[model samples]
Target chain A: MDATPVPETTATPDTECHTTHGYISDKARYLARLKRIEGQARGIHRMVDEEQYCIDILTQISALTSALRNVGLGLLDDHLKHCVVDAAQLGGEDAEAKIKEASDAIARLVRS
Target chain B: MDATPVPETTATPDTECHTTHGYISDKARYLARLKRIEGQARGIHRMVDEEQYCIDILTQISALTSALRNVGLGLLDDHLKHCVVDAAQLGGEDAEAKIKEASDAIARLVRS
Candidate 1:
C-alpha cells in the first residue's frame, strides 16, 4: 500500500484536499430522502397550524423521527464502510481520530 | 366527584364534545416550535443538496431528531395529563383504551 498522501493539486476540485466522504456515492439518493423528510416536517407544521388532534400529531412526529433515524444510520454505515476503512488502512493518529469521531457520533445517535 | 358527563350542548365549541386537551393551553408555543423544526428539516435538506461534510450533516440530523423527540415527549405528557386522566376518571373500557394508546405511542417514541 502506498503510504504517501495524494498531492492537493491532483485531488478533484469538488472534494478539494480532503478525500471524498462515503455518502457522496449515494448523494442523489440521500437528497431524495432528505427532500421527503423536509416535506414531512412541513406537513407536521401544517397539522399543528390546523389544530389537528394531539395523538395524531404525535404519531406523525414519531414517523418523522424514525425517518431521520434511518437517514442517520445510513450515513453512519457509509462513513464506517469508506472513511473509517480508508483511515484504518493508512494506520496512524488519523485513524484513531476517525474512530473516536465515529464512536462519538454513534453515541449521539443512540442517546438522541 | 361528578361522574356525570358534561352535556354536549354545554361543552365549548373549540373542543367540540371532547374536553380540551392539556396542550391546548400551550398551542401557540407548540406551533412555534414545530415551525422551527420544519426549518431545521429544510436546512438539512439543503446541506445534503450542497454535499456538505457527512459528519456535520449527521450532527444536524441528531439535533433535528432530538428536537422531534422532545416534541413527541411533550405531547405524550400532555396526553397523559389530560386525556388519560379524563379516561381514568370515567372508569371503563375507554380508560383501558386510552392507557393502551398512550403505551403504544411511548413505545414508538422510544424505538424511534
Candidate 2:
C-alpha cells in the first residue's frame, strides 16, 4: 500500500466550486469598497508618520475598525442565509454539522 | 421630497446575484457542520439546565466558541482569496475598496 493514503472524503460530493457570475459581481462591489478602505488606511499611516493630531488618527482608526466589522458581519449574514440553510435541507449529519458550525461561528463573532 | 429617496446609484452594476451550483454545495457542507455544532450547543444547554459542573459547561462553551470562529475565518479566507482578488483584477476603485474593507475586518477580528 502506498504510504500516502488518500484522505477520507467528507459528506460533500465533489462538485464545481467556482463563484457564480452574480456572486462575482457582488464580490466586485465588495472589493471596490475594500479598496477605498485601503486608501483610508494608507492615509492613516501617513497621518501617523507625519505626527498628525493623535485624536484625529485615533478617530480614523476607529472608523476603519468599524467599517471592517461591518464587512465581516455582512458576509456572515450572506453565508448563513445561503450556505448553512441549504446544507440543513439536504438532510443528514452534513446539514446538522453545517448549522452547528455556523452557530459556533456566529457565537465567536458576537464575542469578538 | 419623497420620503423614500431612490438609493444613490453606486459603482456596482446590478446583476443576477445567486450562489452558483458550486457555491451552493460548499454552503451545504458548511451548514451540515453547523448542525452538528447546534446539537452540541443544545447539549451544553442541557448540561447547564441539569446543573452539571460549571467547569464542564464552560469548557464546552469555549470549544463551541472556537469552532464558530474557525468557520468564520474559513469563510473569510475563501472570500478574500476568490471575491476580493477577482475584483482587484477588474481595475478601477472597486478593487482597492474591497481590499481595504477586508483589512479592516481582519483588524477587528484580531482585536476581538
Candidate 3:
C-alpha cells in the first residue's frame, strides 16, 4: 500500500555497500572454467552435427556434465565459506534462509 | 604378423554394412537440443563475465547439467533399444562386449 511505512531493517545503501558475491575473489578462474565449458558445449554440438558415434557423443556429454558439476561444487564451496559463514556469524533469519538456500542448491546439483 | 591368416570372424564389409548409430533417426531433434545447450553454456559464460550473482549462476549451471543428463539418458535409451538389442540378438562375444560397454557408459553417466 502507498500508506505503508518503509521497514527500517530493509537493506539500504550503507548495508548494501559491502555486499559482494562469494565467487568475486575467484572470478577470473571461474570465467576461464566457464569459457572452457562453453567450448565443450560447442564441441558436443559439432560432434552431433557430424553424426559421430553415439557412445562418443555420450562420452562428451558426460565430460561436459562433469565440468559443470565441478563448477557448481566450487561455487557451493565458496558460498558456504563466505556467504553462509558470514550469515551464520550474524545468527538470525537471514542465516537460516542462507542455509536453506544452500541445501536446495545441493539437492538440485545432486539430482541434476 | 604379415604372414598370419586374417580371422574370418573379424568384421568385413558385409558385417559392417548395416552398422549405424541408434540416434540417427532422431538426429535433427538431438542437434536442435545440443544447439540450445551450446547457447545455454554461452549464456552462463556471459553471466560470469558480467559478474552476475553466484547463486543465479549456480542455478544456470544446474539447468545446463540437467539438460545434458537428459540427453545422455535419451541417447542411452536409443542405444539399448537399437544397438544393444541388435547385438544381443546375435548372441555371442559381440553381444557380451556391447552389454559391457553399455554398463560402463551407464556407470560414467551416474558418476558424472
Candidate 4:
C-alpha cells in the first residue's frame, strides 16, 4: 500500500476523470480556436503595416475580439459543465466556491 | 507495454505532471478568487435591492470586472507557463496549438 502513489484526495475518482475529460476537450478546442485567431491577429498586424484604412483595422480587431470572446465562453461552459458541476455535487465549501467562481467569470464576460 | 496504458500519447510524462500541477494550483487560486468575487457580487445584489445609486452599482460592477480580469490573467499565466511551455518544448503541432490558444486568451483578456 505504501508503494502505491495515492492520488490526491481532492475530488472523487469519477469526478476527476469526468473533469479531466472536459478539460482535455476544452484544451483541444482552445488550441484550434487559437490557431484561427493567430491568423486573424497576423492579418491585423499586416493590415497595420500596410497602412490599411483605420476602419478596416478596427473591424478586424473587433472580429478578433469576438473570436476571443467565443473561446472564453467555450472554456467557461466546460468549466461550468464539468468542474463546477462536480464541485457542486460534492457540496459544502467546494460547491460554494465553484458557484462564486462561475458567477465572477460570467460577470466579467458579460461586462465586456 | 501493452497493458501499461500508453497515457494517450499526448505530451511527455514529465510535461503532463508539470501541467497538471500548474492546473491544480490554478484551480485552487481561482476558487479563492471567486469566493472574494462572490462577496462583491452579493454586495452588489444587495445594493440593487436597496435601490442604491446606479453609479455605485456600476462602480461595484467595475470592481468585479477587474477582479475577474485578474483571475483570467492568473489562468493565462499558468497556461503559458505550463501548457504552452511544455508544448513548445515538444516542438510540433502541439506547441503551435498551445501558442495560438494562449494568444487568443490574452487577446480576449486585454480586450476586456
Q: Best candidate per DockQ, number? A: 3
Q: Which stretches of candidate 1 lie over 4 Å from their true place?
A: A1-17, B1-17
After superposition of all CA atoms, the RMSD between model 4 and the true structure is 19.3
Clashing pairs in 3: none
Model 3 chain A poorest ten-residue lDDT run? A1-10
Worst 10 residues of 4 chain B by lDDT: B10-19
Cα error, candidate 3, residue B91 (Å): 2.4
In model 3, which regions exceed 4 Å deviation?
A: A1-18, B1-18
Q: How well is each residue in A3-112 modelled by candidate 4, as lDDT tens digits?
A: 64767654344434335644576577689889999899999999999999999999999999899887777676566445654564466655555555555555567557
Candidate 2 A-chain TM-score: 0.71
lDDT tens string, model 2, A1-112?
Answer: 7565788743244221122322343697679878988888999999999999999999999998778767667666455434543443454555446544544554456565
Candidate 3 at B62: error in angstroms? 1.1
Clashing pairs in 4: none
TM-score of 4: 0.43
Worst lDDT 10-window in candidate 1 chain A = A2-11
lDDT winner between candidates 2 and 4: 4
